[model samples]
Target: MTAGRAAMLLALSWNMKMEEEIKKILDNKPNLRYVVTEVGGKASEEFRGKIIKASMNAAINKNIIGKNAYESHALLHALSEAKAGVTINSSMSVSFAMKVAIVRSDHWIAVAMFGQSAFHPMTNHERGGFGIMHI
Candidate 1:
């Protein structure tokens, strides 16, 4: 097997929990906050945007630029609080997200996954959500 493939496998097999993931990041850099979103699509964006806005910053502005590179201005907008922010959207599914999260050893990665009971009506597999159907 390829060395890179072996490394990826090792990372995926590493044991870690949800809260622990964030905590690990926070532990390393207490000055930074995390915005956990799914890999792509509108549903994931809207779902995770809520967490970013309500929990991270209330003032969602137009300063966010480009097709990607979101949260560049958002971390700055928070004002006199956190030093920096990072958004992790490595995967759309819970399992894949966890795998990606584990894959990265130096930096923390995260994904917003809804539980089976607490489903968001706005979230659908077509729109990049961890739903019953896959696109």
Candidate 2:
């Protein structure tokens, strides 16, 4: 892997280790089926790489489905049965993760928000079902 990619992977691992609280939250939610982290396009190529790798790692640990390709429909199916979701898109920021999680969860899995405030651009009315955690 490129140095940048390696750095991202390391960073992601570090974040995972550091965020034990978050992991605990996920573990508590038995219904949660998947955890997603968006690979933001603008957040440096290295960060994006980290996001993807981190997401894969989270998937393995959480035993959830990780979508790296054409599986939107399948993802949605999994989301419907899931307890929670984690997304890392800068477009809507981490808050969007809450939106995505809430919309997809069938068992009311708690949502954990991460990322920047810039994600706030996403309004509640546009998508609906953001009852999950805000941050």
Candidate 3:
């Protein structure tokens, strides 16, 4: 693996291990599916939005069809009835990780509040959602 990729993986593992609060919240649930991603780049907001949305769809799709979601209109016979009803994902500023976790479900997660986010502080909206937490 590339050094950058390896570093990111290590950082992700470390965060999962060190974040007691997140572990407590998860409580080793056997059903919920979660994702970890990084979200800071020079790309346009439109691009970022699409990436976030697609990632969510793909994660959920994999849970059901045993493959990536293709936005198919045809009926997909369930390979497995099991799927996550709710999804949880997290992003943090570490060696390499998503800057923030974005969701369309109209809820906020974690300590950051950035662009187009409902939660805010006395700062630029675009610069919002960058709150740093150990979790």
For each candidate in the order shown, give its overall lDDT on alpha carbons: 0.27, 0.33, 0.27
Count clashing residue pairs in model 1: 0
* Number of colliding residue pairs in model 3: 7
Q: Give each model a TM-score.
A: 0.22, 0.30, 0.30
Query: 14-91 in candidate 2: lDDT tens per residue?
Result: 255544544455455454444535333233445434544554455445544434443233433333222122322334
The residue pairs found clashing in candidate 1 are: none
Model 2's TM-score against the true structure:
0.30
Provide the clashing-pair count of each candidate structure.
0, 8, 7
Per-residue CA lDDT of model 3 for 50-97, tens digit only, reads 435544454345441123333121112110110110111212211111
Pairs that collide in candidate 2 are 31-83, 32-83, 32-84, 33-83, 36-86, 38-88, 83-109, 92-119
Superior by lDDT: candidate 2 or candidate 3:
2
User: What digit string (tens of lDDT, one per residue) describes model 1 on residues 41-98?
Assistant: 2224543444344433222222112223343242323311111112233233322121
The Cα RMSD in angstroms, rounded to one decimal, for candidate 1 relative to the true structure is 13.3
